[model samples]
Target: MILGIITDCTHYTSPSGEVCTENHILLRQFKHLSAYFEKTIILCPFGKFDDRKVTTTYTSSNIQFHQLPLVGGNAMKDKVQLLVTVPKWLRAFKMLHRQCDVVYQRFPNNLNIPGFIYFWLQRKKVFATYTGTWSGYQGEAASYRLQRWILRSPFRGPVWVYDEKGKEQGRIRNGFSPSYSVAEWEEETAQVEKRKQRIENGLTTYKFLTVGTIIDYKNQLAIVQACHVLKQKGFSFQLTIVGDGPMKAELEEYVIKNGLQEEVKLVGKQNHVSLRQLYREHDFVVQAPLKEGFGKVPIEGFFHGVIPVINNISMASQMIGANERGFLFDASKPNHLVETLLSLPAQQHLFAGMINKGRTYAKLQTLEAWAREYYETVSAYYNEA
Candidate 1:
């Protein structure tokens, strides 16, 4: 069967007119998922390419790219463009719906809204992957909430969501996204042993790392503040902030202003290889975002044998295994994160079990496993038809 995917995942059209992406996670995921279907049609936003250092390429032979204009924000221009492009979006999904046998819509996305409607009206075999906070948050866009309600309440379409493990009834299923492949996961056992020894021996210098676009919603500034607190407390630790964004300048200035230059290193974005190495070297992955769907960093950290330290979000407790696998803090109070880290010495005894459980979870939710399971779930659901 041919699979159709509509997502906000950005694909880049290079200066040479070739389509590729720096989103290695999605690149690997789509490629692997394509193996299950005869063909795949990916309808996504294609933007002007930034000449980034790292890229995970895609071939047009098997997976076709259906480009859509970018739609975001609440500005007047954004609203006008969103309105004007309605026809393009509708026409695109209408065309795709006829050719594809199954539709995989990545939801809580503006672009996928039209596609979701087109597929749903036709009663096409379809499922959505909503990778955002499912249980509502303090400040969420109306469009986001509307899409969530549509998928969860009105429509009974099967969806792979996050953080709704047991509370999810009917077709609403919990899911996770993976960054590493099975071959790379070969050393998981050995890595766990090394992590156990390091934890049991007690860590003198803690290394904390967070990787993502330096955006406000990401709350990376909170991380820098936590580092400042740790430094003042005379804690010997290093904080590494990876990935670049509009707020990079502000974060840099904050680090310089607070005299956290030595303590906090905002190294921008690194290539895939460098990122993997950084994950392996770090003792913990600190995710302080105000809200998140799955907050994939912890899962990626789990794969590399790095524990998670996250702020309380929808999935925080569940993903952290109720603080058994990792630690959860209050984002409102940055010092809560400081307190969590400071307790490491006394809490060291819980490390081995946590590390083992984390790695085991990561291994089970690999890219292949995610794709395969999604395929199986959607297939089994369609079988009931």
Candidate 2:
């Protein structure tokens, strides 16, 4: 079978003439999914090496990339570029679309305007993965709302959502993004076990990590505020905020002004390999996003045996597993994060069991495993026909 993916994922080329992406998680998925089919055609907006987003390369062995002209941010300036570029890209994509036996369209993207509609019109076997907040959220784009609206009941194929089980919303089903492999999971868990043995003498400094683009909705600032609170109480903790965005400077400013420079570090995006090391070195993964889809970082943290202190989001609630896996805090409540962290040292002893449960849960959430589940289900639909 030939697999065609329509994604809004921006890809950057590397110095060695390789098709690479900063999103190593997506890169792994692409490679794994391509292995299941004779050929995989990726239709996405591609950019040059100067884009500075290169990390891991996508497989070119049995994969063909049909590029779309680079479309940048959601601003009007970015949208205007599409008016002239999208027409030719649509025509090009239509030609590529005919060769695919199945279409896997990742959602809430500018290309989804054409990608989803064209696939649906052609009556192709479409597997839509809504990678954003599936239940909707505040200040969401109309495009996002429109995607959810159309993917409702009787959408002809599965609508993979971030939520656990994706409930009974007709075509909507559970889908999550994964990063680690089986080998990586084993290595991390082994390290976690070793950590339990070493840390029995009791903890010292609490190492917290938050990975994602530095953004307002991501609520990194709130975590910083919590850090300031911890500093005031003379807590021995450091928050390393990984990944860069528009809000990095603002976060840096806050960190410096509040004399939190020593406590909070806004480290820019790291490659997949470095990210694993970061997870291992840290004690806890803290994310309090105002809205989110299924974040892979927590799953990664869990696999690495780091306790996940997540906020009130669907993914967090599902993965917290009645607080046995990790702790959950309300992002809406002011000082809630600070309060949660303050109580952590008191409950530090119970973290090992929680980490074990989290590891057990995350072991099955590897890229290879997710690909197997996705391939089987989507391929079976075609088999039935």
> TM-score for all predictions?
0.93, 0.95
lDDT of 1 at 171: 90
Poorest stretch of ten by lDDT in candidate 2: 164-173
Q: Candidate 2, overall lDDT? A: 0.83
Residue 297's C-alpha lDDT in candidate 1?
A: 89
- Angstrom error of the Cα, residue 172, model 2: value is 2.1
Per-residue error (Å), model 2, residue 128: 1.4
What's model 1's lDDT at 210?
96
- Where's the lowest-lDDT run of ten residues in candidate 1? 51-60
Query: lDDT per residue, candidate 2, 1-385, as tens digits?
Result: 8988888787876778788777788888888878899999888888766755637877559988887788767789877887888787678668766788888888878777676667677887888888888888778888889878777744578777887544755556777888888888877656888888756668889999999988888989999999999999989999999999999999999998999878788879999888888988898999988888897778888888888899968778788888998889998888888999999989978888988898889987888988888898887766886
Off by over 4 Å in 1: 15-17, 59-61
Backbone Cα, N, C clashes tallied per candidate? 2, 0
